[model samples]
Target chain A: MASIELKDIVKIYKDRKRGTELLSIDNVSFSVDSNEFLCLLGPSGCGKSTLLNMIAGFESATSGTVSVGGKPVLGPGADRGMVFQQATLMPWLPVWENIAFSLKLAGKGAEERRAAAQPFIDMVKLTGFENHYPAELSGGMAQRVGIARALLLNFSVILMDEPFAALDAQTKLEMQEELVAIWQRHQGTVVFVTHSVDEALVLGSQIAVMTHRPGRIRELIKLDLPRPRDSTSAEFNEYKRHILALIREESALARADAATV
Target chain B: MNWLASLREQRDRLWVPVLLIVAWEIFSRSGWLPPSLLPAPSTVCRTWADWVFSIDESSQANAGRWIHDALASSVRVFVGYAIAVVSGVLLGVAIGWWRWVEKTIEPTIQMLRPVPPVSWIPLAIIWFGIANKPAIFLVFLGAFFPVLMNAIHGVKTVDRNLIRAAAMMGGREAQILRYVVLPAALPSIFAGLRIAIGSAWMLTVTAEMVAVKSGLGYVLWDSYYFLRYDLVIAAMISIGLLGFLTDWLIKLLMSRILHWQHGQTVQGRNH
Candidate 1:
């Protein structure tokens, strides 16, 4: 059974100043099999994040349904964990508290929360920094805390919206590797959103390429490349080229459409 | 080496106060102005010591009344500031969180905010009589707005994503508000609290001058009538010191609560 199903999702944003309705995601639909690492790859403003938000229940579909494990999403719940691009860990919370934040909300005692947060903290390699606040952390470390917090939620599905996009190249690569390892061990459904084709290829079992505004799924490319996929390999290059071409074509069409308007 | 660096920093900070004192001493000794009108720093210190220690009756009725006056003023400040902190934070959070509260309450508060707290003295006096009640009421009026404004701002400006993140972790509305909203708003609330403390002292003194008759402001005013400029100067210095002490106390509390913000000093970190 699919872990997440989005049936004909439509999201229209009212632009009151422009006197028009902007269709951000138009008739988008997809399904993620249990434990599948799916990436929604698109250009900026293509509603990839919007689609992820819908699945995460951070957003409501204008005219469609989103279900996780056959349960329709009513609002943001513990069944779906989300990691934001900005690593939105509460600035006032220390690393351990952030990781165990969900448990805290659930009224778990301090010791239980601390004990539960430990493994994920170790998984994210932020063990010693558990007492440090988010402000004291480096960007990469903060993002690690974000990931740990999501993992601690122990949700069946984790949604990430460009989680590593703000990091430097080295940090992004390192995080990508750590993410794959974490996901492999956890085996949970992941709906990742990103603009980077290479990032999609590295982390996703399936990459859903999306077109520009009034976003529609252009292609859902299933990648069967083996684990620890080599970025420099010919297969990786071929996939990257195909994805890049798809994005460029969409961008060109969007530009032409803008010009006509 | 770190101690030396900190001492150097301390010296840089002390320069302004030192210069001001020296300049005041020079002006008072120059005799351009009447000595009675402008007491020298040394004379003021002597009067202050007498007021505090009761070494002599140089300040007459106010001699040794320093402790009582300081305590009375501080008590009013504490009561008023405490009420302001609690109510301001609660109401601010409510206004920020609930649209109905914001619409109904915030506009009225904002309208009242522009009128000076001092301007409410006559009304406060009439309502509460010439006692601590009037002083405290004035202090509350003065201090509440800053705390309320900051708390509201803090809650409103909390990163929306953090709330979403909390909700994702099985947080109910109350849980989200407590664990997420309140903690997230602490830094801003602290900023408001600091600002309110300053206003708290200002209003306390103003209240003592007019509505109340037992604090440092009362002593200052009473001394002026007696033509005891030295006592007036002493009272002024006492108020200044107390104000500084209260502000420092607030800063200490803020640092303790917001120690998380130390390394994130890039923006919105400093009070």
Candidate 2:
């Protein structure tokens, strides 16, 4: 059985100001087996984050089902951990306290929460800055705390919504490498959403390309490329080129649709 | 040199007040105004010292009664403000968090908020019988709305994503409110409490002037009846100083409890 599944999902948002119903996701369906790192890649407004949110139970589908580990997702639960686009750490909590927040919720004592969070804190390379508040950390360091917050939960599925989209290029590359290494050690299903083709190519075991607004899965490409993916190599460039072409065609069709309307 | 430089800075800030007091003394002694009607700052200071130290009978029946009156007012402010803090925060959080609470309770509160607290004086006397109860009731009326309104705004404006983050972690609703919502809303709640504290003192004195007769406000009003304008001015100065002290104390507590906010806010950055 798949670790996470979404079948025939359709989401229509009520735009109250415009007095209209807009379709954001249309008949999208996919599943991820346990231990699969599936990246849902597309342009902005593709409803990929919406799909991820549905799986995480932050939102419900207007029609159809989202289930994890053979059970339907009714609402957000500890079974699926999520890392948001912005590092939404409580501004009032220090780094370690933020990482140990779930433990705190679980009624763990301060000593235990500190001990439990240390490994994940160290795993994310934020060892010495434990006492620094969210406001004190840089963007990259704060995002690491966010990642650690999710990773410490030991959930069956992890959903990420453009978790590193705001980082500088060097930090993004470094974080991507660190994330893959951490995922290897602590294997679980991951569904990452991103607008960057290179990011998807680098991180995903299976890349699901999504079409623009009224989003649908356009294609699913599996990568057998060796680990430590070399973006400069021919095989990597070939996959990047193909994904770029697909995105170009999708945008061209979108422009045509606009013109006709 | 460091202490000297700091003293210079302090002196710069004191000049305006010093000049105002000097001018007032000159005008009062010039006999342009009746000394009995508008005593000089020097006369007021002498009466205040006598009232505090019982050095002489210049302040008459109120001499050495300054501490008693000040404490009485402070107690009223404290009791009423405490009740306001507890109930206002509880109700405000409930209104902010649940639609049912907001719908049922908030409208009535909004209607009641506009009625002047002073206007409640007659009702307060009839209801609580012109004792500490009436004075405390008046203070509660003055302090409650600020605490309630700011708390509602604070809870309402908490980052939606933070709640989502907490919910995603399997935190139950109560846990989310206690650990997430309450802490997130605290900075705003503190802001309300500061405003409420000022109102608490104002209403306490107002109540003492009319409904009750023990605090600094009573001293001022009673001294007026005896035509001791010096004692009246002394009472006014006492209320002002006490209000300043309470506000400073709250600011100290805020800095400690919200230590995490130390470098985050624009105000914090300046300090």
lDDT of 2 at B134: 95
**Among all windows of ten consecutive residues in candidate 2 chain B, which has the lowest summed lDDT?**
B262-271
- TM-score of every model versus the real structure: 0.92, 0.97
Per-model C-alpha RMSD: 2.9, 1.6
Per-model interface RMSD values are 1.0, 0.7
Q: Which candidate's DockQ is highest?
A: 2
lDDT by residue (tens digit), candidate 1, A53-106: 888888898999999999999888887788999998888878999899888888
TM-score of chain A of each: 0.97, 0.97
**What fraction of the native alpha-carbon contacts across the interface, defined at 8 angstroms, is recovered by model 1?**
0.94
In every candidate, how many clashes are there?
A: 0, 0
For model 2, what is the alpha-carbon lDDT of residue B36? 99
Cα deviation in Å at residue B11, candidate 1? 5.4
- For candidate 2, lDDT tens digit of each residue in B18-108? 9999999999999998899999999999999999988888999888988999999999999999999999999999999999999999999
Which tens-of-lDDT digit does each residue in B59-80 have in candidate 1? 7777888999999999999999
